[model samples]
Target chain A: MNIVKLGYKNIADRPLSTLLSLLLLTLGVGMIALLLQVNRHIQQQMENNIRGVDMVVGAKGSPLQLILSAVYHIDAPTGNISLHEAEQLRKNRLVAAGIPLSYGDSYKGYRIVGTDHQYPELYKAPVSNGRLWQEPFEVTIGATIAQNLGLQIGDTFMGTHGMGEGSEIHDEHPYQVVGILGYANAVIDQLILTATESVWEVHHHEEEKSENHPGEENHAHEEADEKHSETTAHDGTPGEEREITAMLIRFRSPMAMIQLPRMVNENTNMQAAVPAYEINRLFNLLGVGVDTLSTIALVIMAVSGLSVFISLYNALKDQQYEMALMRTYGATRWQLVWLVLQEGLLLAGLGFLLGILFSRVGLLLISGLMEARYHYSFSGGEIIREEWQLLVASLVIGLLASLLPAVRAFKINISKTLAYD
Target chain B: MLITRSLTFSYDHRATFQFPDISLEAGTDLLILGKSGIGKTTLLHLMAGLLSPGTGHVELMGTELQTLSPAKLDRFRGRHIGLVFQRPHFIRSLSLQENLALVQYLAGKRQDKARSQQVLESLDITHKRYDRPHLLSQGEQQRATIAMAVLNNPQLILADEPTSSLDDTNCLNVASLLKQQAATTGAQLVVITHDHRLKAHFQNSILL
Candidate 1:
């Protein structure tokens, strides 16, 4: 019986137009929200994982790929670098600490990273049970690995020869789980960590086994051994040739940030990639896609507003007699105006809620894909500040769309309209 | 009491109307008869405060309609005058019952459902209360309009061609209904129409 009820009833009576407007609005708002959440989660995860690491020194290849592999643990390493060469750089006066990472094996597709205790300390990940890995071939698993594999402390698993699934199993060098880290929401959550010798021991066992047992190793095994020895060449020291996939570096000061990367790239065989700089380049490369999507979403939002305007404007024409009739029944001009405006506001408010729900569904699907592939998921729990601004923008669009129709309702000539009717 | 003193109006110099003065008492019924193009609806609108008169004033219950602000005039008209149009207009989105309820709300009164139901009962269209006005039969929609016009029990009930499109029997029936509802509320009834079949229904008639 009130104006709001009347406006809502009017909108409900015209189902097709109302649905068209709502659909457009939902799509527009949902796409924009999905893009915002995706970008926020990516930037947040990258910034969180690269907090303490200053530079990543790895085999020369795509620097972005190197950062993605070395820092985020999502992609494959470019190639292995000599542990002797990495150690010489780590011992420099400008260096504060270096966490060496050697990962070429996986247990059921989850990477087993061989690094020192400082790798866990860099992420502030505390051991939840048992203890950190100390002996070679002793593994400390991350939270996700333990939960997914149903592995507990003291459980044993063989590492596969390659980073992907279905690789040759290294049953001779099976890893025993010694500890499990708590959920740190970082790259380590998806990794199994151990001492550096664990990864080398797996490959070194293969080389020795092939030499002792003749006519057993294939060309792939021979090639794997050759690549392994090339990166782990001896520095005039016999019987001890260790290689690492990458070294995560931290600087003593900002001066080292400028000089150390150039020194490593020019004077050494290893490639030094700054995580922050590489990630920025990656984002800039990704910016074109994001910007285009945002523009499309914004255009959809504008089209939704236009649809709302057309709906209201068209309905106003049909309801002229009713408006005059209401005036004759004692409604003032402003009441009629408010009635139209309220319809617009109701559409906008409902569209916003439905759009957010749609975005959340989209986020769930996207996070599922990301978690399955990269073991990193976006948290859509909290609404960001920009969405609130988006809400304000939606309301303003609704108000603007309703403005002319409301004015027409307000200025309707009741006497002429009623007489003509 | 209802009073209008020589109300005159014009529409952008295209045409002008000099309406006859009206003075009526409470609880009395009068029929104002005029053909189309004679400003019959105009005079009714001026009386209902839906239009501004070029000259003169309409005073209802000792309050001059011209003296009130636009907002105040709307509320005053809502509280004091009930209008029934020729085509029995209703807020198309609302059911017949809600339309009646909306009328009481517009009059600044609480939406009294019992009163609305009772009015529909008096008009004998209570069975169709939940139906939208457009779904009702022509006779039923006319009854619903009558029910709406008397929902708030105003002091004046103005009907513009209220029976111009009905048969002789339905026309007389509508006229009696309007008069009976007005008498029950102790309000003055005025039906302005050219139908002349309602000429014998009301006690007082004025033809232009």
Candidate 2:
């Protein structure tokens, strides 16, 4: 009965073209929104997990891989560096806190990392259950690890020799979960924390068992050199030249940012990598693909706008006399103009709503895939600020697409049309 | 009363129309007969205020419609005048009742559903009020069109070739219905057409 109802009926009468425009708009907006969401997730996950660790020093390899393995615990470590040499580097005045990580073992596909209290302190993850691990074989599991593997406090489970499932099981040295960590929204939530000596002693026990029982369970260590276990003063246990996977270092001042990384690379066998720098490099390398995808989405959106224009234009041509009839019934030119514009705006608004739905569903599917592969849950259901701008852009498209058509409606000659065109 | 003097219009420099003076009192009817190319529709358009004449005066009930602003003229026309054409056009998307409501709304009147139903009933087409215009028969459509025209009860009713496309029986029915509705509303009626069948229905006749 009203202009809005009239405009809506006009669109509803032509379902095919309306649906086509909506489909294109939904796809374009959904693609851009999904890309924006994933980029936000990756940036957030990287930044939060690398908070206090200024640099990583590991055995010589790719600096990016060293940061990925030592800091994120998502990649294989760049070989092992000497613990004695690592301890000597930490003694320097420029280094404030050095947390050494040693890991090559997994229980149920969750990596078991051997490090000190500094690692938990860096991510501010408080032990929510019993306590932090204090002994060689006792473990404090992260929240994700505890939930995924269904391990509770005081539970004991044997760890495999390598980083994933289906590796050699070291059944003799079953690790006990002494505590469970609270959620920190960091990489620690997916790790199992134990003392540095646990990784060393597990291999030590394995080596001796192989020597006595030789050639059984020795294939796992056939490439590793046998270390001489003499009584060492470090922990009062018989040990060899101990090795660690990497050391995560925090600086005493900003001066270390200039000197520390270069000094480690030049003066020692270890390589230093800055987490912030490496992550930026990673994004820079990925930015080209992101740009290309964004351009495609924008192009699709423009085409949807064009489709709206064509549909409205064609409908207007067929309804010229109907419009003239309205004018003769005392409707002003502006009223007729608004009728057309209202149809365009209505389509744009509907397309935007459907597009948001498309993106959120896509994000959930990606979240499930990420949980399965990387154990990083990007459960982002909140709308970011960029979509508001997208909403404005969509309205603009509707307006621009209807501009000429509305003008034509405004300029309609009532006499010529009603005289029966 | 409705009056127009020295009305002139042109689509271009080559095609021009200068209409004769017209005046009609309330509760009476006038029929204007002309051949196809004699500007009968143009004269009706000028009097309905659907077009601005090159030079003229169109006055209805002491308000000079030609002197009003474009927007004001539209409102004046919506409030004071009703127009009908040969094909009995309507907003095809709306049902018959909705079209009447739309007309009432455009004329700055309240959407009086009861009044619209009463008008359609008087015209004997109230049974088809819920149907779309395209779904109605030709006689039913003409009656619905008359129902819409008189829904506002305007001071003037103008019809341009209103019965040109109808058969003899339906043509007399529509012409007499227009005259009866105008007499009921106490409005002046002007019918311009090439169909001479309408001459018998009006008291005053003019040939252009």
Candidate 3:
């Protein structure tokens, strides 16, 4: 019989032990697969958001928190900077383009971003239908928000006061959904964008009427007066005149990243955060656990290798007489060793298949949860190249595991074994 | 021809066997009768090149079995020696025909389907050639092992208790078949057993 056939026979003879070993190997490999795919997906999402913004400027606080809240729409914003201070930074000759973001409002769980028309232009996100938000109380929804809320171009919705659900709603001034942005696989596709004036209108509608007295009503009714009347009435209004959540700054030169953030912190109350630095810091913090997990996996694989050796050793001990009989019938010791190692290869190969199967099933379940709660999309597809490497590595380790038992088989005393009975 | 000279073996530092000289020519059937643990199986193993004698030399056809390396000894044994164990030790996973084919392949002999079938037919196990050893009866498994042993047509046939578990009729049949096949191949046949019922079948006898 060929070596492969012999290996197959050995595995078939001990079906339960073979299956248990394979299941253990699959657990280690499957975990590595899931971690690798999720890490890749997160990195892709981060890079997409960091493309247009060269620097982030927010009120003095943790730089990492500022970047997380600004770029990924995850954490809460650090406190706001003054509007006059932001306008000064925008006017600098080194600055190329700046887009301001006003927050503190949301619809359902999705953040309602109050920014200019340049906000969508900054992300290069095109409106899938209708026009951009131009009038007060007009809004443009993201693709996911539109789909989930079943809101079309003409549908109107009320904005809430805070970021999460159960926040107080501004039922007095309802907003109309005038447009929907196409999917960009970024944060823009998961937020609601409108004019900055719309945010001021919702919060300062009561303050506007209180300042218009009986004699000043005729002046407020004038065309030019009506435009400046709201600004004059709430001149100290924190909601209307206060700074925004964060500013996205792009420099004309890449060297501005190094020279500009230091200049901003030294010259103003705002702090600048570099996306790359914070991302690396985040990975370093997370990488320790990932590395520890990988080390544990390697150790488990080594144990599994020893398991293969011990099991094969026992099997050879039990089959001594049979081995001697084969030897007498012209079988070489090297051929016998090959037969044992072949079993190891078969076990590893089958275990790898099971590992890949479990990874896909795991990814599918995770994707369902992410889509339902966070509205994030995940695709089920072929195994990536890195996952394939894990499989090949497992096989190599298995082959190494079988080496000791194979050597023992080669050194067996055929004559003594035959003569013992 | 098989020859041994001053062959000595020990167990636990105590000498168990000392054969000064013995030679068996081709086509001779020798029945070895000994008590249990008398080194009968050991002597057969020495003649079959399965064990090395510490004190002296054993030669089969012209090559000294003691002078060869372990690897060369294994190859020599596979091509020149045929051994039947006390109980048939067939590889349980393989069919009877595959068992025979593996013996031929390991001996570097071309697979001869006609010869394999003929051996099976002689043992009346031709119908069970495709069955695993576990599916066969004790006598049938023993016959299959015997068929595999003779598949390569070795220079010497060594049987260790060939009829230990068989009925009287089957024992006589197995003994006659071993002698007939050895005579046909012009090979020396050595039967090592404590069973005295097998003594009358062979002309030459050694009592230990």
Q: Please name the candidate that would achieve the greatest lDDT relative to the true structure.
A: 1
Better of 1 and 2 by lDDT: 1
Candidate 3 Cα deviation (angstroms), residue A108: 5.4
**Could you tally the backbone clashes for each prediction?**
0, 0, 0
Q: Which segments of candidate 3 are over 4 A away from where they belong? A: A59-61, A79-84, A104-108, A116-184, A192-243, A262-271, A377-396, B1-28, B55-76, B93-101, B108-136, B153-155, B177-188
Q: Residue-wise lDDT of candidate 2 within B142-167, one digit each (tens)?
A: 88888888889988999989998999
Winning candidate number (DockQ): 1
Ten-residue segment with the worst summed lDDT in candidate 2 chain A?
A224-233
TM-score winner between 2 and 3, please give it. 2
Per-residue lDDT tens digits of candidate 3, residues A1-421? Answer: 6658767887788777776778777877777777777777767777888887888888788899889877776676776776667878888877888788766577887877778888788778889998899887789988888888889988888887656466556688888999999987788888889877676666566345535555644432332211111211135665446666688888888778778899999999898898888988998999998889878877766666666666677777777777777777766788778877888888888877887887778888887787666656566457889988988888896788788777877877877777666
TM-scores of the candidates in the order shown: 0.97, 0.93, 0.80
Using DockQ as the measure, name the better of candidate 1 and candidate 2: 1
Model 1: residues >4 Å from true position, as ranges?
Answer: A212-240
lDDT of 1 at B167: 88
lDDT of 3 by residue, B118-207 (tens): 888887999998898768888788787778777778888899999988889989988988887787678789899999999889899888
TM-score, candidate 3, chain B alone: 0.95
Considering DockQ, which of the candidate structures 1 and 3 is the better prediction for this target? 1
lDDT per residue for candidate 1 within A1-421, as digits (tens), equals 7998898999999999999999999999889888888889999999999999999999998888899988998787788888888999999999999999988678887888889999999989999989999999898999888898899998998987665565577888778999999988888988999888777667766767767786777743543423232123233563345788999999999999999999999999899999999999999999999999999999999999999999999999999999888887788999999999999988988888888889989999999898888788887547888888888888888899999999999999989999887
**Which model is ahead, 2 or 3, in terms of DockQ?**
2
